[model samples]
Target: MSRDATSSLAAQIDARLSAPGAMDAARFASFLGGQQRLGLTHGGRALCRHLRPYLIAEHDYAAVARAAERIAAALERVARRALVDAALAEELGLSADERALAALDPGEGPFLTVGRLDMLVTEGGFSFIEYNADSPAGITDQLLIEETLMALPHLAPLRRGRGVRAPAPHRALLCALREGYAAWGGREARPTIAIVDWKTAATSAEFNVLADLFSAEGHRALILDPDELELDGGRLSAGGERIDLVYRRVITQELVGRRGLDHPLVRAYRDRAAYVANSFRTKPLNKKAAFAVLSAPEFADLFSPEQRAAIAEHIPWTRRVRSGRTSWRGRDVDLLELIGAEQESFVLKPNDDYGGKGVLLGWQTPPDAWRAAVRDAEAQRAIVQERSRARTARMPTFRDGGVAEEEVYFDLCPFVFAGRMEGAMVRLSASAVSNVSAGGGVTGLLIVDDPRLKREDNRHV
Candidate 1:
């Protein structure tokens, strides 16, 4: 579709929202009450305060999913190669401890059972910024958010018989976990799953919600912190329950950093005692440098013609922050000199951080401060990527007993389970960085089939 067509669809939704009596103060308050009752929150605030969810066309979503799957498969291939290729490992900046754990045999499972790739959909097209293969969040609460929105009387007009459906990331998550368990040689009908993460983590509400979902599906589920885990009689147990599958939410770097290689989780995974989603082998591709590898010309031979085409089309120009020479726009240049000259066109990021931490947007930073950051990045693990413009739209934001349209930057984050594209999470922010932890808000992504548009397939969510 053309840019005008896309804007027309989004504008239509906004029109419905701005219609009289559609989204009044009382209705907004009731929506908040419903979200609170369901515990759909992030950082102690309601997950989304908008009256309408992010509307995406079914065809656009299918294209986005296709791009995501191709790029993710390419990354997984590189990740598996990085496990034994010393030069590739060095390029990815893997630490000694990380290398040791990544090399350990993770009995049977996809390298990344559950992952999320952050992408931006703009008029120019879709550009994937980063891959979160380690431990992707924002899965379960989407279902609750969708339910809350569908129940709101204000949104019924747009959703009625239009086939407006939210993608089921939680369902895909459960399927991946069960498949991983079966691949790990489990014979049980449903394995006991554990949602493990730090005890004081702010996203604890999401963990509880996921645990409840698992229990309702006839699987014994437990929420436990890493400290509460124990290995007894060559078996892994947590909270006095045997864990057959571990839906590990703990970051690999944090796990190895705090507990070292001898951590019971690591030992159990290495010994094939328990199945772990996103096995330790995910460390290499989890880094932001994975984008660097994909975009760099030296590694072009690692991908097929189709995969390479997807890489060039979807990935931005990215390179590790080092003082050496690298290619830019198909030409070799001094990396440091180019960064120093064109600071406004790039973004500096830590190779292994999340939630917008240690991220420096060059366009938003002072020249002197950006120079210092560049020097610091060169000395450590970091990547400088060309900035992709974030897509913006006028969304109905509620405030002070009224609803007003405000322009917000939003991103489309699709969840990938065992190499298949499932649902997605839409994050809206007033600033360039769009993240829930960075003062951004999330809304359910409703994939609606527009009878007016041409059909791509008969698939329904």
Candidate 2:
């Protein structure tokens, strides 16, 4: 980045931090403790861990908007390409697991109707790190986290001075749910929407908040487990009411594992007895192999010029676990050899797990351990991605009864609905991983006096 640009960013951040309420760590912790009443706590602790917040400028927000468009396009291309030519999709490659998922009927919806794009901040804009269309868990929570932090008196100046506001993803999500009901031909003025997931899932709290939000919006919303549902005579009913729309939040594959895909919900969706926001088709793109399809040269022609450019610019070097010759930096290289040679520059992750499970950081592991992770990845159909340099910055965190300036690493995740960019989640951490589930913090969104930023982006919400 140019010196002026860097300094400009620093100035914006400083403006937010210069306030009195900027760094009360103890108060932040207490604030989190009070979130249980709001259903924002997880396992008895606040879901948002970072005390320091993100202060994004208007230009940075616009850049994220463009990045989201390109990402949505890329995901669409992959899903359509795979559908048009199953044989060609095979060439893009996958593990037996991902292949099976790809074969499943995704039903009639965008493969990734509602999901998130995890990215790293960069001078150019944002680096696409991972596409998470399958099971996006934290859209509402992210917004809530930001709002919770903004309520602090010390940070009140940032809101009053900069016109700070974070977009509510739950509102956009409701629109998508309503759209799904309409697609299912439901004529109810306000369809009964059920947030379907495992009864014991950690996100149950957010489900309650959503249910309340839906009630306020003129819809009867219910949070229930799949097992509690019954498909009697083709009508999927839950809690004694005929469900018109199902805002499915369960991991289809995992749910399928427990009860085959032919389960009532799956069958109901296929038969048009009900509607699912992210249809069954999203399971395919949920796999890590989709990244391989996005970055692999063999599949480059499948995407449009814009998509190809997005892949090249934002996506890092990535490949399926299988051994093969592939292009890297515009040239072909032996995949296994390169991975084995440069252990620190890579990471191995399970194609379908969440919450940082089965992820091995090469730089943090010993040589032997990295080799094991590489071999295991090949054995289980995993993905190897080049490590991204997620930027770090110093923030005032309350520690020991006073604000302590500490440096933290963070990542940006843009929430997309039907391939359209809506809002983003910011996860800050002291370590490399910035997932809230992995001890990261979420900060509020600030617009610096752009009231239109709220109204214009909020048309659908």
Candidate 3:
């Protein structure tokens, strides 16, 4: 496409947002509600069933694919290193008992079984922040929302680019779940899938999405909050049904403690319930410290010289910040001074929190606030990471009384099922945090095939 054509397409989108007598947020909300109702009434549990699927922008796909390739290679290197370490630990008469326990699937292990990619894509390219190796949410939710969004009439014209196509996340998810079931000693009489999460509104919403997807796949899906489950004679029972496959969405650390060794849910999970997604092993990988394993001197041979150099350039420098522990003593001794010096370049993150909570972006807050946050971080098991500037794009949004401009960016979350990459969930957010709870809108991921748009040359706008 020519520059003029691209500009024209962008203008069309802008015009839609700035149309004469533009719709207000209240009207937009009403329209959205009506669409949701229509989906529920016509599609029978599917949201936004009236809209058609939109294709992923071809230029965006090239950028995403390139970034994914690099990240996948790095993950492969890291996984290989872990496997070698596990083998060596076993050979050297270390962790023998642990290995035996792992063989038994004792619900406690050091190795991770699944991984997730949280990334951002801009006109420049894609930047991956970290891998959610434990329990990444939004796979099923993304598909649900994507399917719903594509059915809306308002979004139909938005799919004008060459070979626009939304990736089928539902089909991809079903395949992954079935693969996990088959891997756990083949199919059974009836596959009983359990979606596990904490008993909270947010977690409940996630469970609802997964349950709906599982139902569509002809499986007996049970949504169970950990607190509601009971272990009766080594069987997991929730809502009067036994669980065979567990789609674990709860934090591994929290689940282990809540459903102790004796609970039926934990016992079933440990003994026979095939964890469809991430299992207990994901805990270590979810740790910020896991990235340290990538930079460790002991794992130097994991990557080729070129790949290693690329990794160093691409991955952010992450250091574990513990109370009273001087990570870099002689190099930088001025904690207070440095905290104020590079306020805009650092991010303080808690080790185990999600949905963008407990994240303090130094550049977004006041200097005094940044100092206070840094001091608190120093008091906790938090890590200070180098912040990469994520470029944002403008999206049309309806505010309370008028059409307003909203900052948006592409969140390309690739789902890795059973250690293999499958598909992605694209989330567009107005704020820096692209979480659904943050009121971000979602769209379908479409991959175009046009040769002109398929090339990497169009990455820059």
* Model number with the top TM-score: 1
Which 10-residue span in candidate 3 carries the lowest summed lDDT? 41-50
Candidate 2, 398: how far from true, in Å?
A: 1.4
Q: Which ten contiguous residues of candidate 1 have the minimum total lDDT? A: 1-10
**TM-score against truth, every candidate:** 0.95, 0.88, 0.76
Best by lDDT: 1
Report the lDDT tens digits of candidate 1 across residue range 85-182: 98989889899998998888887667789889998877678789999999888997678886787566656665565466778999999988888888
CA lDDT scores, all candidates in order: 0.84, 0.70, 0.56
lDDT of 3 by residue, 238-307 (tens): 8667776777777755655555445555566666644435554344345454454444445557667765
> Candidate 2, residues 19-63: lDDT per residue as tens digits?
676546666677676566676665455755444466664545666
Task: State which candidate, 1 or 2, has the greater TM-score.
Answer: 1
How does residue 373 of candidate 3 score in lDDT?
77
If both were scored by TM-score, which would come out higher, candidate 1 or candidate 3? 1
| Candidates 1 and 2, the one with greater lDDT | 1
Ranking by lDDT: 1, 2, 3
lDDT of 2: 0.70
